[model samples]
Target: MSGEDFEDALKYTLQRKGWKLSTTKKTGDFGADLIGHDPKGRKVVIQAKRWNSKVGVDGVNQVIAAKAYYRADHAMLVTNQYLTNAAFELAKRTGVEVWSRKRLNAEIEANIPSKSNK
Candidate 1:
């Protein structure tokens, strides 16, 4: 998926999971694609990356900066691909959640609405 498409998909997914979501401006986003409050009202800042290659530390740094800038309680970096080792290390140190394809899929599966509920 393209970057824009990934952003949209993430927005929809978060909304389905009961987040009040909003997208940042395209030109001057400063690394944040989506910002919102989760179901329990914790603030969240997210950076969405859809790339063929592994993501780098730069993206992790951006999300960390954005979390501070937005005064969010949680920060997440969601990517269609996996992160580089450097990025993973940085995220671990910074308490930023990194959601690669596997994690994302697991989250979706866990949160899927039951047939009876739907």
Candidate 2:
């Protein structure tokens, strides 16, 4: 999937999870790709990566900077490919959640209505 596809999927998943979603705001320069809010209005900063190869820690660092810059309550890194070990370590250290393709798929599935009922 392309970067845009991943972003779209992320937005869809968030909405399915009952989040209030917004695109990159023009006036607010969070340096992050997307901004979401939970039912209680907690901020969620999302960084997207649709790389053909594994994403390294640099991408994670960039998003981390954006998270601090934005003062978000929580941050997530969503990628089509897997994150490197260094990236995982960086995310763990920075309190950013890393969601790989498999994780994303599972989350999407869990949020969706059961096929048997639907």
Candidate 3:
């Protein structure tokens, strides 16, 4: 999917799972693609990426700033592609949740039943 499509799809997927989320403006979003509250009502900021290549430290870095800019309690970088080792390390160290393809799919499946299941 294209980058914009991926962001919208991710937002829809999360909403299907009952998360209250809002998409940020395309410009001047301050690095946040989506903003919302988690289950415990803590604010969250997310940066969504759809890339063929492994996501790098830039993605993690963006979310780091997004959390601070949004004054969020948590930050997440969700992507259809996995992260680079360096990005992974940075995310772990900086408390940015990196939701790689596997994690993203898991969250999708949590609420979206497959057609095969019927």
Candidate 4:
């Protein structure tokens, strides 16, 4: 999927998980792709990356700045591909939730209604 598509998918998944989402403008977003409140009402800022190769620390850095810019309580980086070691380390140290493909798929799967239930 493209970057915007990835962001939309994540927004839908989060909405299903009870987040109130607000997508940023296509340009000059100040590094935020999605901004919203979590289930418990804490403000959250998210940066979504769709890349062919491993995602780097730039995504983490952007989300961190986005969090500060938005004054959000939480910051997260979601990527379709895996994160680099440096990205992971930085995210861990900065309390930025990094949702790589595995976790992203889990969240998607968790929210998808089973066919049997449909």
What's the TM-score of each model vs. the native?
0.90, 0.83, 0.90, 0.95
Clashes of each: 0, 0, 0, 0
Query: In model 4, what lDDT does residue 82 have?
Result: 95
Per-residue lDDT of model 2, residues 1-118, tens digit only:
6566667777887887789877785445455778868677888888888788988998788788777887889888888789889998999998988888798778878877777976
Best prediction by lDDT? 4
Superposition error at 38 for model 1 (Å)? 0.8
lDDT of 3 by residue, 22-101 (tens): 99999998889999987778799999988889999988988899999989999999999899999999999998988899
Model 1 residue 52 CA deviation (Å) reads 0.5
Off by over 4 Å in 2: 25-30, 112-118
Q: Judge candidate 4 against the unseen true structure and give its global Cα lDDT, from 0 to 1.
A: 0.93
Candidate 4, residues 25-114, lDDT tens digits: the string is: 999998899999999999999999989999888888999999999999999999889999999999999999989999999999999989
List where candidate 1 sits over 4 angstroms from the true fold: 109-118
Q: In model 2, what are the clashing residue pairs, if there are any?
A: none
Give candidate 4's TM-score.
0.95
**Whole-model lDDT, model 3:** 0.90
TM-score ranking of the models: 4, 3, 1, 2
Off by over 4 Å in 4: none
- What value of lDDT does candidate 1 attain over all alpha carbons? 0.91
> Which ten residues in a row are the worst by lDDT in model 4?
53-62
* Every candidate's lDDT: 0.91, 0.80, 0.90, 0.93
Write one digit per residue (lDDT tens) for candidate 1, span 1-118: 6788889888888898889999999878877999989999999999999898999999999999999889999999998889999999999999999999899888777777889997
Better of 3 and 4 by TM-score: 4
Error in Å for residue 110 of model 2: 2.4
